[model samples]
Target chain A: MEWRWDFTIEILPRMLSAMLNTLLAAGIGYTIALVVGLIFLLGQRTKFRLCNWIVRECVEFIRSTPLIVQLFFVYFVAPQFGLVLSAWVSAMLTIGLHYGTYLSEVYRGGLEAIPRGQWEACRALNLSPARTYFRVLIPQALPASLPGMGNYLVGIFKDTPMLSTIGVVELMHTANALGAETYRYLEPYTMVGFMFLIISLPTAAWLRKFERYVGRSMGITK
Target chain B: MSTQNHPLELPEGSPLVRFSGVTKRYGDLTVLDNLDLDVGAHEMVSVIGPSGSGKTTVLRMLMTLEKIDEGVIYVDGKPLSHMERNGQLEFANEKYLRTQRTNIGMVFQQFNLFPHMTALENCIEAPINVLGMKRDEAEERALNLLDMVGMLEKKDQHPTRLSGGQQQRVAIARALAMRPKVMLLDEVTSALDPEVIGEVLNVIRALNSEHKLTMLMVTHQMGFAREISDRVCFFYEGKIAEQGTPDQIFNDPQNERTKQFLSAVLDAN
Candidate 1:
């Protein structure tokens, strides 16, 4: 089948709206993942043996399982258990939890990269626990954490297509619908691929700049 | 989450810091074994020993950096590592630990200044946040301390921008901002370049002669310790082998181990 420029132009508005939905899904999911990642990171840091073990196991389980399976379970099986969330809600929760485990590992790696001397220094200064983590430690952790966090941000954006199987009207879902209705698969699928490229490329570049700025502000050259 | 106690907080004339029958073990290797030591009010004592002799562990325990496996540490007449629990001592609660930690400050071998903060920020953070001092007051006192350490001009520089000696001076100023009654110097000059050791030693010398601070240091610089320490203790295998005024410990050593260690150390220098 020949590629149809006219058909592509005709469906451009719908695809644009679907692009917005994709961004919204990625944005909201990333926000949830950022917060949930911190919660998971704190869980890993706690001293309670059972709690630490439980949280560690949970993170491992999430990271090991496929995101699509989690999406299916959240969208399909959860309703049987009486938690009947919308497709968007289920997808967001699954993506947040799945990527959140990855992000927690990033945070753990960043924290471990800090020298033991920093902790001893905080003890020596007699800084409170809250002050030590927030003011002193986290600022240093950010420079080390930014690259991994940026990687997962892009990872989550790419994985938003998995939401389509659960029937959320994001870019890929919109493209599939357009293809089925017009009996033409090429233009819609190709447009979707180009749109993702247009967005992801600039985001990766911007994240690099952001990482450098964060490092510079934290007195970490290179 | 346990109720706390301060059994060592007796009112009458207790030592400023004491480790009573303290023991530290790492797996099966004992680091500090049944250690007993005392620092009186406003005294300067230097601990000298070869590596792994537990000189650094002594200061680290007093600073509450290391846990005591078998005994109690007293600071400012109160329990430091343990609290009295129904007539028995247990690992201290956080409230007790924090209360004791405020009485002590430490300088590290690596001069671990907060790299993200300027020297002035490093000095004032504890004063304003931990001590709840007003910002202007904290800044004022921080500046004076920077000036005293001869780091006043570089107060705005981050630690990464400073030389090792300059950073150590700033670290000293930072510790002084806490107003700690006891200061621990754990090989403070050991990490510096040989040329810059004199600058850091000069700051410490001024701190010893000019301030009434109770200072305990673990040092390899035998000459500096002999010159500045009021009392010198030679440690061997986690215990003090000999202790006395500098003249007695250095010139008239009695313990054979002390003699051997000093001769080996002095010959190396």
Candidate 2:
């Protein structure tokens, strides 16, 4: 089919509104990922053997299962269990849990990146364990982990389209509804693809800039 | 200056630094088995040995950086690590340990300087934080230490920017910033280039003569150890195979281990 100017012009405003909804969902999903990732990371580092094992198993299970299945499970199973959640809430939780597992590994890798001698030096100076982690370990670990964390940020952004499968009225969902009513698939789908490119490309670039800035500030790069 | 007030005294027969039947084990391997050692006040003792002879372990144990599987270590007539009158094993009161450790400072083989901090900041960090000294006082003392080590000009540079020898010198000054009576040096010059090693060795020799800091060093540099050390302890297979003046140990060579190590190192050089 040939491109139709009138059809594209007519649908432009509606598609823009859907784009806003998609951006909002992505922002919420990322915030949840940021917070839930820390919780999962702490669970992995906890002293309790059973809790650590259980948390690891849960993270691995969630990670191994497809995000689409997770979304469907949260959306369909929760109502049966008498704990109904809004489509938006279900999508956010699923996305958070999905990405949190990866971020925990990032945190662990960063914590281990610090040389053993740094810890021994702290012990030699008799710094308390609390002081050792906060003053020496975290400061060094956080910077080394920044690049990994930034990669996950981009990954989370790309995964936002999966929310559409669960009736979350995000970009793809709105595009589907518009196409069903108008009998026009190409315009909305193409517009959704363009909107995603607009958002993700700049975000990836900004994260790259941010990673360099963090490295320079931490003195890991000259 | 304050050395006169310190008096440099060991109470009667008590050792200023003592390792009483200390044993260190890593899994099934016994690194230091029932080893005992004593360092008198104002004495520079050098531990000489072949590889894996447990010379570094002795220094690490004295610095309280390594745990002894058996027996106790005493410093200045007090147990360096033990329970209080409550009669329970503890993680060791960190604050008390910090204070006690101020008397003993250690320089690592790799120099292990804080890479993020400047050379002056590295020297001043422990004094200000661990010793609770005023920032101005610590800065002043650090500058004096930088001058002593001949690194005052490069005080603002990061450790990575300096040569390995310069970094070791900065580390030595950082350790001495605490005015420690007993200093531990673990192969500090081994990582340095041959051309740069002399500058570090000369600095250490000057510090020993000028400040009379009681030094315990684990070194493979037989010539430097023989020249600077008053008493040399030859360690082999986790035990002190021979102990005597540098002249007796190097020239007379009482133990086969020392003789073998000397010949190997000398032939390599």
Candidate 3:
């Protein structure tokens, strides 16, 4: 296929507009994952043996399964069970659940990175368990978790293209639509790749800078 | 065990801290076995032992950091590990433990100051939140404590900014802000550089002589233990093998284990 400058120009605006839905999907999906990850984290932290085992197994199950399979199951399979969800809802739920499991591990590592001495110090101070976790432990955990958390932010963004398979009108979906209508595959597909590359590279850089800033702000010298 | 005679005499008025038949185990490995000890009001008691001798566990159990596997600990004449419900003994709940635990303060070997907070903030945190002291009052108390530990200039610095001895000093200050009746020092100087050990020890000596706070220290510094402690204990195999005045335990160790352990420690030094 010949490169067409005019054709690429004609399609740039449409692709740019589609990037909005892409960002929206990633933002909402990441927010959901962040909240859902905490719920799973609490499940892992709870003392009840049965509840902990069940949540742990569920997290493992979601993490082990591919995101695409989860998306298809939620989008295509739920209707037969009389629980129909919109394409956006299904894609969001799937992305959230899949990434939420991964994020929970990030949270777990962060929590574990804190020394056992910190908890004993809190106990020595006679702080309540709730106050101890919230006031002392979580703040310490965030500095350690920020890099992993930021990686997954970019990760969720990169993975948003998978939502196109389930008919979400994100960047890839719009690119596919333009290709089907115009009978030209080169420009839209290349633009999608170029756009993603530009966005992901800068974001990953900013996140690295952000990670150091968080560490410094938390008074972690190393 | 060299010193077999348990010389802990619980004075007429209820002693400040008492451990009776307290036992702790990790899986099948018993860390403390039927340990019985006492600290009178404003008394200075030091514990010295071989590595696995349950000395640190004594401080840990008093801090409520470890669960007692058997027997009961008493603080200010109240059962600590268990509660009486309808004349039946039951494991004490977290609420009961928290209420009972406020009287004790602990300084760890690691100087486990909260890294994210300023020294002043670390001192003020629990008093304001747990004690419900007004922020101004808490800060005032905290500043005074910081001044006492000779760390007033470093109050705004995070713990990471301080050296090991400095951090321990601030830890002592932080513990004092709670106004605990008893302080448990678990090798607080073990992590310090040799030169800085003097500063940390000086702060501790000041605390011992100037204040009436009952102290239970598990230390390896035989000289400091002799100088400061009213009584010194030698623990062997999860039990108090010997205990008495520092002179008795050091110069006239009663048990074979105590004599052998002291000689080994002296050789190392």
Candidate 4:
């Protein structure tokens, strides 16, 4: 269980390679979450009552249930339906769908934070609904929503280790494999935790700074 | 004798705005019920009343921010919120509605200026984008408007940095930028401090005197309303209980509601 400098140094290159895969997975998952969140937001805003209700229920169900269960279901249940996806695809799809629900609420909150008078002002100006949303609403709403969205990005980054469960050789899986081969849990596991803290801490700090910058610009500074 | 023989023509000045049997409701709750009212063209008409009297609703319904459960609103003899083809009420197309909104501009209790935009940018936004004026032209007009409001120096500042009075002035400039035929004021001064209220009211009074913009204001500031408004309407419980000139309503009140309202406002030290 004692830390060994030579062994840690020897495996550091392999761990760094796996770190690249982990970062890539987080990037893809975050991208999918961003786009899918907008889709769900649009679904909730649609006029049809049934569509709205169904989307609401589905989003609520997804939001309430555990992401691990959802991931397992997608990874396991799909093969029974005569379809198969690579572990990376399954992980991305699950993470995206899971976080999409939370992000949709963030989008909704941002939209609602806008005063009713803003919409009336747009109407008074005779802007079309499309222009109103794009030029006025979205510009304000996106900045208001960014902090929440940034938090989710960090959440997705931390959750990338879950990808290792489905056989994706991300940081956690690489640590596990290295530990088994070297018969040393302390070095690889501790190194994996350090790698996460190193990447995520600065990213979280950057997101906070970004949120402050946007808040100042939007006049919503705390 | 020659002048008499030639026949003198009387200048035509009557009600330019007419609300006919207008009713507003939220489900079973009636906010404005079966109301009829009128104001002469280029006249400043103030609606004064207690809370829930539908004074604000009158302005809101005119702006088409609220739908009428019944009745019609006409501006320069054109129907609002409905279409008339061959003298029949038909579903108006959105294009028609869009054109209709341009004829009327409104100011609210809240300044409602786009917070992210500078005062000049807020003034010019609608003209360039919605009215499709060239950007330079819009900016020029917006500058002129800010100059009129005496906020030309502060045009580059955002709304949050400006005082409540300045924000309201910018909002007034924004509303006037459209060059609307009818301007609706919904307690524009209520949110400002007493000292700042004078500045906003001064801008409005000047606009009324200089340009003759037809104005309908819902207000609680009885002194300002009395000094500026040509006529006053007493709205009580979703109806116009009485309406007349400021002299008639204030000096020689006829309706009990108007008497009670004036007494209350005057009595407040």
Give, for candidate 2 chain B, the lowest lDDT window spanning 10 residues: B1-10
Tens digits of per-residue lDDT for model 3 on A125-220? 999878998889988999888889999999999999899999998899999999999999999999999999999999989988988887788787
Looking at model 4, give its docking quality level: acceptable
Residue A121 of model 4, lDDT score: 90
- Give residue A10's lDDT in candidate 2 (0 to 100): 93
Model 4, range A1-222, lDDT digits (tens) per residue?
A: 578999899999999999999999999998898888988987877768899999999999999999888888889898999878889889999999999999999998999999999999998878888778777787788777988998999899899888888899999999999978978988898899999999999998998888788867876453
**Distance from true position, residue B70, model 2, in Å?**
1.1
TM-score of each: 0.96, 0.86, 0.95, 0.92
Distance (Å) between predicted and true CA of B206, model 3?
Answer: 1.1
* lDDT (Cα, tens digit) per residue for candidate 2, span B215-266: 9999988999999998999998899999999999988997888898888888
Report lDDT per candidate.
0.90, 0.81, 0.90, 0.86
Give a tens-digit lDDT track for model 1, residues B1-269: 22233354546698888877788889998888888888998899999988899999998888888887876788877778887767766788777788779999999999989999999999999999889999999999999999999999999898988999999999999999999999999999999999999999999999988896899999999999999988999988988888999999999999999999999989988
Deviation of model 4 at A159, angstroms: 0.8
Q: Candidate 2 lDDT, tens digit per residue, A1-222?
A: 767779988988887887787778777887788678778877876668899899999989988999899899999997999979999999888888888888777877887988887777666665666666666677677777787887887777777778888887778888898889989899888888888888878987898888788766655567
Candidate 3 second chain TM: 0.94
Candidate 3 lDDT, B1-269, residue by residue in tens:
21112222334587888887778899999999988888998999999999998999999999988888877777787777777676555667888998988899999999999998999999999999999999999999999999999999999999889999999999999999998989999999999999999999999999999986799999999999999999998899999999999999999998999999889989999
Score candidate 2 by DockQ. 0.40
Q: Give the TM-score of candidate 3 (chain A).
A: 0.96
